[model samples]
Target: MIAVFDRVLIANRGEIAVRIIRTLDRLGVESVAVFSDADADAPHVRAATTAVRIGPADARRSYLDGAAVIGAALAAGAQAVHPGYGFLSENAAFARACAEAGLVFVGPPAPAIETMGDKIRARAAVEARGVATVPGIARPGLSDADLVEGAAEVGYPVLVKPSAGGGGKGMHRVDRADDLPAALAQARREAAAAFGDDALFVERFVAEPRHIEVQVLADAHGAVIHLGERECSLQRRHQKIVEEAPSPLLDPAQRAAIGRAACETARAVGYAGVGTVEFIVSARRPDEPFFMEMNTRLQVEHAVTELVTGIDLVEQQLRVAAGEPLALTQDGIRLAGHAIEARVYAEDPSNGFLPTGGRLLDVRWPADVRVDAGVAAGSLVGAHYDPMIAKVVAHGATRADALASLQQALSATRLPGVTTNIRFLGRLLDLPAVVAGDLDTGLVDREVPALSADPVPDADFAACAVHEVPSGHGAWRADGWRLAGARGAVLRYADGDGEAVVTVRERDVVVERAGSRAVVPRAELADLEVRAAEDGATLWVSGAAGDRAISRPALVRRALRASSPELVSPMPGSVVAVHVADGDEVALGDAVASVEAMKMEHVLRAPVAGVVRLLAVVGAAVVRGQRLAVVEPPTDERRP
Candidate 1:
């Protein structure tokens, strides 16, 4: 297996790039990384053999710019380009351009991409092959008026999205006739912004369906096979959260049927390289599966398949791209013990799962599981890319064993600086439904309250007081003062939970709150890093329990931001939309503007019902807390 290509250019960023580089290195194939200004110091860039500055922080000008990627590849003297799952990975034109430029595109052929990349066309192809598809209306030249009528025929609840979209971008669930038009418009907006194509369609919305997909591998020699099934039903916002191989919901007959259908669908489109054929399995009709869509590139959840099969999908992808036949046949592919993967994101589970941006102070992954990470302890998470920080996959001999390992892995995963969904994932894993292997796409949203509920232990807050309380401002810094003088510091947050005064007596931390006092272990309070730099107060504690943090300086910054005249960006990102104008009256909960960063959209809302004064324009770059619009209260309800 002489190296297929001397050097392969990784035409993306983040964890996927890191994952690909590891395989390329093992194959003795050098890797070149292309990045924007936001990723000058990213782990993936450093991991590659060499790196090139593609463009600014905005994804369109850098990662999504097909020409720039190819130019960088040529300049780096790379023989091939590996579009790592996102950005331009599924762009057929990009694939054609790479071929036109004499560079090997490490993915499906352009014809196959053009065929399956469009959901409308993919559905037609699959349906022609006798594959079952969800009830829907989609085709070129389909009118909005016709779609509204189509919705009536399809039923009240349906999904609207771009014909050429993946992930959850531009996808909307409309449950009412009145909401259909608005949903379509918003879906088109998102679709256009994400894929540059706004041709929208509608499909019957499946109620609480299981998202299962089959991994398919093919070669130029015409060999193709399915690598079993992956249960990707655990999701939120239509994005997968947890994935496992050899779906617990599938028996031998169902598995064989679905696998055959997937391979049939792949071979139908002349599919090559590695791909995933996703299906929606209704809870009511467990044995029947509906063809949802096909991802022509490697999937984010491909790791679970690798863990179960003990084969490197990336290596196989590379070999296929080099025109080599797959080294293994379907008979040789074996699925062993159960494997589970959990995606760790930079999001606040309690706050409507809003995307979070901040500096990663400390990150420690569990040593037992396989951790694929994109950031380091000092890495900065911005509103310029996807918010996913890492993925943890645990494998065991049995499903129960795998889940136990996954639970422990989540507990051992530590990311103290920025907010994360670790606590939420831990709780989700403990649910009875999950324990019993009964799951659906609606599980997370249905149990939001309990799933996101996180109660901080008293000791964790005491740790925050020790690290965040200013050195001299807090009496705790003073040794037990000579006489009777009480020494303590009051630490408060914007949260409704109020404040607490921590009194330092000898080596112990006495947390006094609501007229009650609880002693905290002195050692527990001093376990992790504490820093109050120009950014903000950072308090981190990683112990046997888990990682937790609350930056008081960040709260103060928010307070100062609230003092401004307008609602502002919660994080730094480019303004994609503005819905209000100067002097326009608006109500609470109205979306005044939408800002996007790291592939997550944050909708700014009116703080008070009043006249709106716009301060930011669409496409304007804004920073954290940058004012976007000001809402003036009515004369009778005005506040100073």
Candidate 2:
């Protein structure tokens, strides 16, 4: 019999917290949710049976405060603590604190966490287990000679990563031998800032490698099993955007090999509960998959495995924590239908995917798809948390079917008031490489422009304008009958760029045609919709071109003009470095200033050669489209 807890405290917020809460509720267990000041009304807090306010919005005071979380758990009489993914999920001290308090930690033991949490030690442990890993050198206080020799042996184009880091932070790719020192220094600085670690290690940079991870579940009874694999090759800045179960590039034998290696790795570490073993599958050869690292906690992409394998990973964690043996054997576990998940973020993909914060005016997910979301309509997306708003998951009998379903769901989904990558996601689903299952880490970088291009067709805009125009007050209203001698209201719309305009009347919509008139009848409007032409809804009224498609809730449409010159800023970010001075001469595409946003540095270049007029001082806070500097082009008389 599985030991049961009277109550469980979830020490995190967002979708994963809600996910754990639902599993707890299904087990007839009371759930206590802790929230920071910013997330007082978050969905996780509302879903839990009991709620407690921790501290301020800063994560160090709230979610990351192990003592505070344990205190709240004790205050609520919770028997166990579940640290959902992220915050304190892999914190060894947090797990120990729970143990010292006589509360069960719903994860691996503290020792396992400490041992595997350190990248250098974990690499050594996995290497002892005879698993093939990339060749690299890990040492502390190594001399420059040592680094040079190590790089010579491992070859150039090596990756320098922090020994105690997660995510893509603290990692740098050095292409040439001369760049190694600077790259190492930068990586160490980032690692120190992010993970409190300055130790660096080098590894052979696998070119165009596909990121695949195998899921392993272990119980206290020493039974561990693998749950297939997830293909997470599509990435931007080392963060996964789309993930799918049963990698399209892997065959049955290759999948089995990877799974076996993953289970063996777990055994070597004596792991327990749900963990992921990430691998760098060489794109040049699909048959070879090398070990990358082990995540001792549940992964963000675990939902895809759950959809395909029909398993509740959180429930398994609870069972394993209670000292129950794994219920299924490796042979018994079978992959079912294909499943795909897309991370929906509150960011603008066109603007370097910077984190966006605003009031969510509207949020709607497809009814037919499974949406794991942390916020709802009217909720504010703030800078205090991750930019991910929701994860849309779709499952089907076949990969093609799953991809197609995900495309349809993405197109139908809507989020207003906050910029999102919804349109970009829809285009990704339709990509030929993605549909054909030919994917790797470099795929998104290669296909980003095409995938992010405007999908609305020109003809659709004309049709929408003509159909939206009001008909006459007289006969044949059901059809297209206009009143005798009546002229309908004149409506105008802009083009895709908002640089040109289109005019629509009761009978026809006029579009620009080679400096002449191009009229489309209202009857043709209905036919365009039936054809499902892209760019239909974004059509600007004739006479206004260069307008962006602004889809509000319930199909309310507006065309927004480009930001004026005074509004030029580095999308959204903190000023990291300022290069231009007021009244300084600058040429077209010259580096004006740089800002750090979304963990990447973006250099705002001058649009035209001119004299810099107004410049924001260093360390100034800026918002999206906020003015940072102004440039006045040289007059004809001033030209050389």
The numbered model that scores best in lDDT is 1
TM-score for every candidate vs. truth? 0.93, 0.82
Q: Which ranges in model 1 have alpha carbons more than 4 Å from their true place? A: 468-497, 514-517, 523-536, 553-565, 635-640
- For residues 1-640, write the lDDT of model 1, one tens digit per residue: 3356989999999999999999988888889999899899999999999999999987889998899999999999999999988888898899989999999999998888888879999999999888899999989867789899999999978988689887888887889999888778778778888888889888998987899999999998889899999999898878888999989999888998999899889988999999999999997786889998999999988998999999999999889999988889888888999999999999888766878877776778898889899999788888778888889999999999999999999888777667889888888888899888899988988998988877566776676666644342434322343322345455543222545565544466676656577888677666554444335544566665566665442244434444444787877778998877778888877879998876677788887788888989999998876778888887678755
lDDT of 2 at 77: 98
lDDT of 2 by residue, 1-640 (tens): 2357879999889998888888888888999999999898988989999999999976779988999999999999998999988889989999998999989999998877887777778888888988888888876665546776798789988888787767777777778999888677667666765566777788898987899999999998888899999999988767799999989888899999999889888988889999999999887877788888888888888999999999999999999988788888999888998999999987767656777776665566787878888988768787667788789999999999899888888876766556678778877877888899888887887887776665344455565444454352232322354433344433344333432234555667666532555666767655342211133433221111111243211131123223223325545566655667777888777777766554555667776677877567666666766777776776663778
Among these predicted structures, which one has the highest TM-score?
1
List of clashing residue pairs for candidate 1? 383-597, 383-598, 384-598, 385-598, 386-598
Q: State candidate 2's TM-score.
A: 0.82
